[model samples]
Target: MIIEPRSVAIIGASNDQDSVGYALVKNTMSARCDVFLVNPNHEEIEGKKCYPSVKDIPYEVEAAIIAVPAKVVPDVLKECGEKKVKYVYIISAGFAEAGNVDLQDKLVSIANRYGVKIVGPNCLGLMRPGYVNATFAPYEPKSGGIGFISQSGALVDAMVDMAKESYGFSAIVSVGNSAMLDITDFIEVLDQDEKTKVIAIYMESIKDGREFINVVKKAKKPVVVLKSGKSERGAKTALTHTGKLATDYSVYRGAFRQAGAIEVNTFTELFSVSVLMELVGEVDDMVVVTNAGGGAVLASDYAEKYGVDLIDLRKETIRRLDKVLPEHYSRQNPLDIIGDATSERYWKALDILMKEKYVKSAFVIVTPQLMTDVDNIAMVVAKIKQKYKKPIVCSFIGGSRVKNAIHYL
Candidate 1:
């Protein structure tokens, strides 16, 4: 189901400026995909003959991206139903989230009867950068690593934007309102997919808690989750919108841990875990190294919350570090080297840390004023491949001057 599409029909196809239809057509064409434009009144849109309806299209489409108004969705879906399309991306809005539980029931009902898997009635849709794209959020990343699933449109767009600037993604999925098919369905499908090595998700709620928990844990692949909507205000908003969650924060947190998934608090942290997953694979323990003691201490404190052991280097290892690391540096779990360390010193420490027995993974922090030669440090990090079979994540916290030099070169 990843990329075996013979053709796709874009419902609500139009040539109007700034139309989602126009953007979708452009994006689809860019991928050189066989496309059919579906619209009742248009003769042609973007040089592609506009079929009056999905039924009129000669070829069978495996997927249909419906961009028409929500009111007309059922009719459009009805047309797709007759054609027996397997996958439908309902990009229109104003469904269950509009406070119509009855309508929501009807939507789910139709999908179940027809054997159609729906992404959303109010979603941006999924983007397969490697092949098929169901979204119109404007992303053309150098596709390679971590796949993304999110609920919010703005956030989904942000993820695409951030990926282009900071990292590469295998795919990006937008889960809005969860009318029928939700994140778990997508996760189940992607877990078996060969192209996707890692999965990062932004979950506000789960539709199938037990199934979802079971699927993710059994995936045996690196999965990073950033669960939001925990506060009273957030809970009220989410509950009012999605009908609420019976399980509380602690319950969800425990579920993530038992499933062997790393649960991060923020979106940036989620992306951080995702980016590092490309380098580090399935870490059971971590070593924290930072130039600032306070920052290192705080990081170690949070590391304990996930049951990830902060393995301190042994006395033998400390003796080796003492031979190389400066006098003021602490050789323990949160290895704190004072402010005077340079990129050379950081590289040496990294070289030594890679040799340490207990450290399965490590996080390096270098603040703005920590040092110069940021390019040199980036080179060192890029050079240190997964030769030792451990994941290494580096965070560049340097000042504005060396910001570009800090992250990957």
Candidate 2:
């Protein structure tokens, strides 16, 4: 109900333009559902009548976004329960993360008595593009295939801005403090969402380790995890941030492997792997065709490190490539066609590699040289990508020279 509510009430609505309450009201005004504002201090905000409480609303509210003070959360949640609201998202802070365990416990107790699911006591709320923007994020993300659940709300804000042009999201959730519902709950829900092709998670700690592994193992879609708190100091910092102690990094890594989840070290790898998985599903036999030998070598090293199989070229495949590529071109899996190669060489080399029945996907690397036609090569790559309907991750290596080509791809 919280992810896509039919009707929602914004508790603690305010007129102060800089306040979180005001931001919540403003962001949610564009949602496709009914939105009601509540504030005891104001009669109306932006010409809309402000109810004193959830009890004052005339109709049923499927979800309530609470942005009130920490001390008032219990009362506000109780009122939501009396009004039969199924979901409540506590956007306010100063809960367990602030060492206020008693206050957090009180809110949780009230929620269970009313059979309500709480999203957070310290979080940024949720967002479903083109449906609802239930967050204070400065920029709303464009709708696409990735469903991202993060412990750090600020990181979600950053990702929204960075991915605006490169990729998009099906939904964005910030699981703050995890007083009631955790990352596992969101993962289970998003796994069944047809629009979400892949699930990406930025986890600080796990509330229930056994349950997390079970959920990921049974997930039909791919699960990519970016875990933090690897160092002792980092784990302590995570505890202060989310009120949950992160276990040893090795333990979490082993668990992820056992559950068949892909674990990435950096944010760049997280989405790169996700986009690849979304487009190609899984590839057992892969190859790299690059104009730079060094780039191919680096790719080979990483492929070995990450367990990606870069299959060797067969004799027949090499013979076919020999006709198109220069005689001196490297004939192995990372088929380096020499740095000075032009777009035609790239087109022919990629065409031959993609046609091999044994080859499933490819990585095409292009380095800017004096003779390289960066823009034309990008067009050729785009054409080949459409023709084969196979995954082709491109690395247009260089600054201004390759910028246009990168954008075209």
Candidate 3:
């Protein structure tokens, strides 16, 4: 079931200052759901009375977070079964990845018998904005339309810290070991979710190749994947990390393409594409407008590299630019307005370009110059964005001077 729980129970709620149990409870304090603490060692934790087990809590919980030791995870799952919790997030480690495959199997079997959906056997848990922040990660992700699933918990931690302000998430999950539920499971659920508009994945290995491909193919929303372990050494490392052999990189790449999903190579590209996919929607083609000649060239190169075609302007479009731009203007696809150009020039050029029937989208590239008003240009771009049906992306290129302008856009 994909329903957000109305109440949650943390099985290993702890009082220790430096423990995952404490982190889970502390982080989830801001959740909208009613939280019940469970730990036999303490009567209370963080001002809430701690119960010995899930069965002992007077109020029934929709979800149970089993954070106890791996050896006792089965017993905790048994108690959760007796209480009839529908969802489980296993935050504890030392299961399959640690060579304790039998224990992990038993844990999944019990949850299955009780009809409980498990998120992880070893993971950092999950975060669903406006509902719960069940992760041990310190920062809470802002609510947005992007849904991210990752195998590496630390990378998720880094993404949460770095992209928290700029990028938002409808849901975020870290799938460790994935004994019961894996990356494809989350993808299937998120694909059907009304809250998610785009899905992003960071996978070291695939759980079920056929199921993963089929789901991605049938998804109505955009799916972006960043698969690690491209090299032989990296594949070996992946096996050691997740206890699952990494699929051949070439086969996975072909599958992603056939599934109509965007496959990115680096973490940087993953976020870049995901943010655009979520906010701007998809564009089959784009045009570039720039004040700096170098920036225009770079944009053109990348546009071609990413298989986005730049539209050729009609003779009438060139005639329109001739009247507004400098006499020496290049008048090409990368419509280069001269260096000392003002916001008014950019506004006029963009207005002309956007009116063309073929220009589906645009990228506004600006470099800091002595006469450049980065902030003013950004303001003009933002306003023009609202006036068009096409998506507009800005590449405000520079260091400290352009930071505010980039943020403004």
Minimal lDDT window, size 10, model 1: 238-247
Give the whole-model CA lDDT for all candidates, comma-separated: 0.76, 0.89, 0.85
Which portions of model 1 miss their true places by more than 4 Å?
2-4, 138-142, 239-247, 289-291, 319-331, 337-353, 356-359, 365-390, 400-409
lDDT of 3 by residue, 1-65 (tens): 44367888988988897998999889888888888999999999989899988999999788888
Q: Kindly list the per-residue Cα lDDT of model 2 for residues 109-207, writing each as its tens digit.
A: 999999999998888886888898878898887888898999998898888888887778888999899999999999998998988999999999989
Error of 3 at 329 (Å): 5.4
Q: TM-scores of the models, in the given order?
A: 0.84, 0.91, 0.88
**What lDDT score goes with residue 99 in model 1?**
72
Cα shift from native, residue 409, model 1 (Å): 5.5
Question: How many residue pairs clash in model 1?
Answer: 3
**Of models 2 and 3, which has the larger lDDT?**
2
Model 3 off-target regions past 4 Å?
1-3, 292-297, 304-309, 312-332, 337-344, 368-376, 400-404
Q: In what order do the candidates fall by lDDT, top score first?
A: 2, 3, 1
Alpha carbon lDDT at 47, candidate 2: 83
Best by lDDT: 2
Q: What is the lDDT of residue 367 in candidate 1?
A: 62
Query: Best to worst by TM-score, what's the order?
Result: 2, 3, 1
